[model samples]
Target: MFKNIKNDLPASIVVFFVALPLCLGIALASGAPLFSGVIAGIVGGVVVGGLSGSKLGVSGPAAGLAAIVLTAIATLGSYENFLVAVVLGGIIQIIFGFLKAGVIGYYFPSSVIKGMLTGIGIIIILKQIPNFFGYDEESAWDLEFFEIDGGNTFSELIKMFSNINPGAALIGFLSLAIILFWDIVLSKKAKIFKVIQGPFIAVVAGIIFFTLTLGNETLSIASKHMVSVPIPEDLSSFVGQFSFPNFSVIFQHEVWIVAFTIALVASLETLLSVEACDKLDPDKNVTPTNRELLAQGTGNIISGLIGGLPITQVIVRSSANVQSGGKTKLSTILHGLLLLISVILIPTLLNKIPLAVLASILLVVGYKLAKPALFKQMYKLGWKQFVPFIVTVVGIVFTDLLSGIGLGLLVGIVVILLKSYQNSHFLHIEDNSNGKHKIKMTLAEEVTFFNKGAILKELDNLPSDSYLQIDLIKTRYLDNDIIEILEDFLYKAKERNIDIKLISKRGTVENPESFINFFKEKPKSNISLS
Candidate 1:
């Protein structure tokens, strides 16, 4: 994990900058103590990063789970009670790891996953627009379509234009320009520019901008518009920020229900983020899903025990890490350590950093995920892939992360079924000297019941006094329903004066009486994974 520390170190600084505001914002959105979010960030980084097989994925208190945490905290009657659920949730996640439930992540289609990444990217850009314009009414970490105060994503976006601050906007624009310059021009010009990433410089520039224009009414960034971190006055007060879970609620049914809910949601979000992170990894490294579950479970347990919200592999920070050239888990761990060290030693300095600066960094991350080139590429792949991808993106933009992915998965399944219905077999007609149609039908590799409609329709439309050839030479698994259909077709063929020929590994028959019997006798090659 430390092998690429030279690159990872700088990447960690970028991730640290990105993760800071997010930790506070997500906790505020979740209705948890602000310090709890920082605790989760630390746990996610140091604990999960150390244990996870994913080098690029950064675990933290996720915005996706903020709503759940908010509702759970209230329903359970107390934050302490919520802590009990989080601990139990971690245990359930560990059990999931042992059960190898991580394979569930693979079931999501590639198009859907890509759509998820794009959707998140779009959401990040949308949510941060307000912050970018210096409209800081809502916590930037809120991910739901509807805000806690009843406004929707677009509504807030509209609200931002009226509240734009010149100072913050200036800082944001300059930060973005600096990042672009460093990324597109300077980084290519020298090795030093590569070592010191643009996002870090952008953040430093934002701080300087905030410090330089403190008293200017037209240009000064407001304190409310800056990064907010809990500043402990002394060592004792810092230690007092930590809270322990109440074990008294361990036996309560409500606690158990909340625990299960958290476990399920956290596990799902983690799996999806890790999958997305793997796709973004330049090395194409495959994160071990089960091991990731184990790591996250352990991190969540530690976080929960110490008054932190539930933890998951967060795509935002993870992508920031990847975009900033993070090569290993060292970046993730270092980012977490930076959070800890900064909160303890430089809280006042950290507070001076503008939210607009962080928003600009995320804007870059969001743009990368939902690049126009990707849309063009998906469109060129055709509707089968594009439909699900678009649906997922729309769902996420209009709804939330998991909801959008669910809609996309449903669409993906429908697309699969539609393709299956159309792709059952290939038919070719050859003119015969007998003035009759000689049709050759080659069955697909895997013929399931879904193909019954297409297969039956073709068989029923066969011309009278024609010759029909059914070939299964390359077919690996022929469904019993299809076999029965073929058997029934044999009886109909005789009445229509249609001569039937069956071809397979089982040998050719001039007029096969029973396809059921032919497939009942199978070869080792003829197998169905289903």
Candidate 2:
């Protein structure tokens, strides 16, 4: 893991910068103590990163869980009571790992996954716009499309334009330009540029810019517009920050309910992030989902014990790690250690860094995830892939991450059903010299309940007084629902005076008395043709 220390060290510093504001912002958004978010970040990096089977995935207090944490904390009556739920949620996640529920992550369609990545990217860019312009209406870390402060995504942007702080804007734009220049021009020109990332330089430049513009009223960035970490005044105050769960809350039914909800949501978010991280990994390394679940569960348990919000594999930090040239879990572990050390020692220094600089760094990350070229590529794959992909992206941008994915998954399923309906069977018609009609219906290789409707429609539409042949010669498996449909169609064929022939791997039957009985009686494989 330490073989590429040069790469991991710089990537860790970049991820640490990206994660710090987010930890604080998410903590503020969740209505929990600011220190709690940092605690989760620390555990997510050190503990989860060490235990996880992923090379580049980074775990932390996820923005996706902020709303849930807010509601649970309020509903539970106290933050300490909420801690009980967090611990129980971790146990449940461990159970999920044991049950091999990790396989569920593999079922998500590739189009939807890509859409999720793009959607999240778009959201990051949109959310960071407010920060970039020095509009401090919401926390710099907030990524929700609908703001907790009672505004939607676009409305906040409109409001931000009117409330821009010149100092912050100047720092943000200049920092962004520096980052872009370093990434596009300098990095390719020199090897040293790769070792020291643009984000790291941007953060240092932002601090210097903030320091130089201190006394100018119009240009000076406010303290609120910069990174804020809870600085402990002394040793006792630092110890006071840690809170323990109330064991009495363990017996509360509501606690269990909240625990289950957190476990389910966190596990899902973690699994999705694992898939996304794997997709983003330059080496194309596959993460073990079950191990990730176990790692997350353990992290959440430790986090909750120390008065932290639930932890999950967060895509933002993971994506940043991948983009910053992180090669192993060392970057993840180092980032956590940096978060721990920064809050304890150099917190005052960290607080001086402008939020605009971090926003600029994220802007680049967001652009990479939602590049326009990806849209063109998806479009070329045809509507079957493009529709779900676009829907997922739009849904995520308009709503939230999970909701958008659900909508996209629904669309993907519908496309599958439509294709199944159309391909259930092939129909051939022949008109003989005597004016009699002959029709042949061939079943697909595998016919299930989804194919029943199409098969039924074709059988009912068969012309009267015509010869009909039902062919299942190539079918390897046939659902019972389809068998029932064929059985019921026999009465209709008799009513229409149509001669029907049943062809299967078994022998040809002029009119099988019973579709079920024929399959049961003739267990041996046979080829039948009319």
Candidate 3:
């Protein structure tokens, strides 16, 4: 970890810039105290980052949990009581880690996971459009398709055009240009460009632009469009920012319910992010899911104790870290430290940076996540993989993150079932020298009820006066429904004057009186025809 400090340090600064607005924006969106968001960011970075087995995955207050936090806080009656739920939720997540529930992350299809990354990328670009134009109605961190301020995604974009601030638009375009040039042209020219990230340059330019345009009526950006970090007046007031949970609420049934809800949701979101981060990792490093859950549980416990929103491994910050050249957990830890120090020492200076500039940085991140090449790549993989991938992207764009993933997963499952049904048997039909049809049906390795329909259709469609051979040489397990189908087909075979040949390890039977009786007479587990 220490060996990559040169790369990690610079990457951490970029992640720090990305995380700051997000921390504040998510908190504002959740209706939680502004400081609580910063606290979550601090704990997510330092504590979770320290314990995590992942080298590149970063943790923070997630926008995915904003709606849940808002509802829980209001339902719990007070923020202090809500803290109790958050602590308990952490405990539950630790239990989940111990129980090895992390395997759930592996069950998600690759298509859905990739869709999630792309979906989030598209959301980031869409949400940041308003900020980029200096339309400050919504928080820069809000990722939902529908705004909490009572507008939809497209509506906000429409409004931003009419309400664009020339100062912000100019700075945003300039910052974006600098970022593009640094990444595409300057970075390739020398090693120094790699060490000094484009985002940092963009931020500095935003601040300078803000300062120079202070008095110009046509170009000056408003305070509303600038970064806002809560500045403590003095030592006592700083301490006042921290809030303790009400332990008495632990006995309340509702508290436990809320705790379980947060644990389940936070654990799921964290696992999804862990998978996505590993996918984004240039080295393709696999993260230990169970350990990640434990780390997140610990972070949430600490965050809640100090009045913060629940934490999860966030894809936004993690992707930013990877894209900015983060090499290890050191980048994650350093970013947390920056969040802590900046809020304490230079918050006033931090607030001077324009949100439009930050939006420009995120726009690049978004574009990378949802690049056009990825869509074409998925399409080339065939519809089985492509449908889920496309559905996940569309669902996420129209709905929220989790809902989109669920929809995609559901589609993927249906696809799997359809394939299973189609592949359950191999049917080969040949015309015998006597002009009668010779039909041979080979059962799949494992035949379940899903295959019953297809098997029945083939049996029913067999031409009359034909010889049919039912082969079960390689079958390991046969469902009862398929056996019943064959049994019922025996009568039909006799009615059509069709001859039947049943082949199994038990030996061949020609025109068996009953299919079920033959199988019951010699029930061998490893029955296979030679």
Candidate 4:
């Protein structure tokens, strides 16, 4: 795991910078104690990363669960009670692994996964716009409904234009500029700059700028615009901030509902991340989805017990992990350790960092995830893939993350079923010298219940007195429903005095007892018509 330490260290720094604000943002959004977010980040990186089989995937307190966490807390009457749900959620996920439920990840279409990533990329960009401009409303964390401040995301943007903080906006732009230059210019000049990473540089600049402004009382950056983790004067004070579960609610129905919600949502997010991360991975490694579920279940249980929000393998963090040169799980592990140590030993320094700087960092991360090239590549893959991809992107942009993907997946499955029904079986007719429409019904290689509608429709439309040739030479298995459809069609043909020829390896019998006995007496398993 440590073999790629040289390459991994730079990646770890990138992930650390990327994860810092999200940890805070998600916690802030979920209405959890700020320190709990950091704890989750630490546990995600150190504990989860250590056990996860995925090489490039990063785990953290997911923004996807922020709304759920908030509702759970409100519904349960306390955050401590909510923590019990989280712990239980983790245990449920662990059971999911043992039950071999992780294969659920495999069923997601690749197009949907790409759409999700692209959609998330768009959300990240949108969400960070406020933070980037230094419009740090405490309500920004509530990303779902119109804010308690009487504005949705769009309204907030309009408000940002009117209430922009010159100091925060200036710092954010400058940090972004630094990051852009570091990636585009300075990094090319030397190996050292490349190793240092652009996000790290931007963060350092943010801190220095904030520190320098502190001395000048005439000009200052606001406290809300700075990193907001609590700064404890001593170890005991920091430890005191940790909130544990109130296991007293263990038997409550509401607790189970919250637990299931966390488990289901966290698992879904993890699966989606795994799929998207695989697409982003340069190595094209196929992560074992079941193992990933188990890993996540274990991580969530640990995170929940320790007062952290539910954990999931997050694409934003993982994508940043990949783009930053993280080559192994070690970078992820190191990143968590850093979060733990930084919060405990260096909260003072962390508190000094500016949120605008981290926003700048995320701004870059979001851009990378939703690059113009990604859109172009999807468009190039053709409309079959592109339509769903765009639907997903648009869905996410218009609706929420899961809803958008659900829309896209719905479209994708419709397309699949259409293709399947169209390909099920068909009758091709040719004129024969016997003054009849010589009909040949060619069956699909494998017919299932889904093909029944198409088969019945086609057979019912056959013309009277037509010489029909029923062919099953290429068919491997004819489902029972389809077999009945054919039998009924033969009866109809008899009533119309239409000549019917049955063709199969078994025999050339025109009318046989039911569809099954007709094909059964031929041979076992590999039945074929001579």
- Which ranges in model 3 have alpha carbons more than 4 Å from their true place? 137-139, 521-530
User: What are the Cα lDDT values of the candidates?
Assistant: 0.91, 0.90, 0.90, 0.82
User: After superposition, which runs of candidate 4 have C-alpha atoms over 4 Å from their true positions?
Assistant: 137-150, 215-219, 495-497, 512-530
**Residue clash pairs of candidate 4:** 504-529, 505-528, 505-529, 505-530, 506-529
Regarding lDDT, does 1 or 4 come out ahead?
A: 1
Residue 284 C-alpha lDDT in model 1 = 99
lDDT string for model 2 (1-530, tens) is 78999999999999999999899899999999999999999999999999999989999999888999999999999999999999999999999999999999998899999999999999999989999989863545666677777888888888887899999999999999999999999999989999999999999999999899999988899998989898899989998999999979799999999999999999998999899899999899999999999999999899999998899999999999999999999999999999999999998999999999999999999999999999999999999999999999999998889999999999999999999999999999966545658989989888888998898888888888899888888987777777777777778887898888888877678845755467555332331221
| Minimal lDDT window, size 10, model 1 | 521-530
Please, what is the TM-score per model?
Answer: 0.95, 0.95, 0.97, 0.92
| Clash count list over all predictions | 0, 1, 0, 5
The positional error of residue 466 in candidate 3, measured at the CA in angstroms, is 1.4
Q: How many backbone clashes does candidate 1 have?
A: 0
lDDT per residue as tens, model 1, 1-530: 55799899999999999899999999999999999999999999999999999989999999988998999989988898899999999999999999999999999999999999999999999899899989953557787788888889988988788889999899999999999999999999998998999988988898899888999999998888998898899999999998889899899999999999999999999999988999999999999999999998999899999999899998989999999999999999999999999999999999999999999999999999999999999999999999999999999989899999999999999999999999999999977758789999999999999999999999999999999988888887877788778878888888999988888776787836454455555542334423
Checking candidate 1 for backbone clashes, the offending pairs are none
State the lDDT of candidate 4 residue by residue for 225-249, as single tens digits. Answer: 7887788878788778888889999
Please give the lDDT score for candidate 2. 0.90
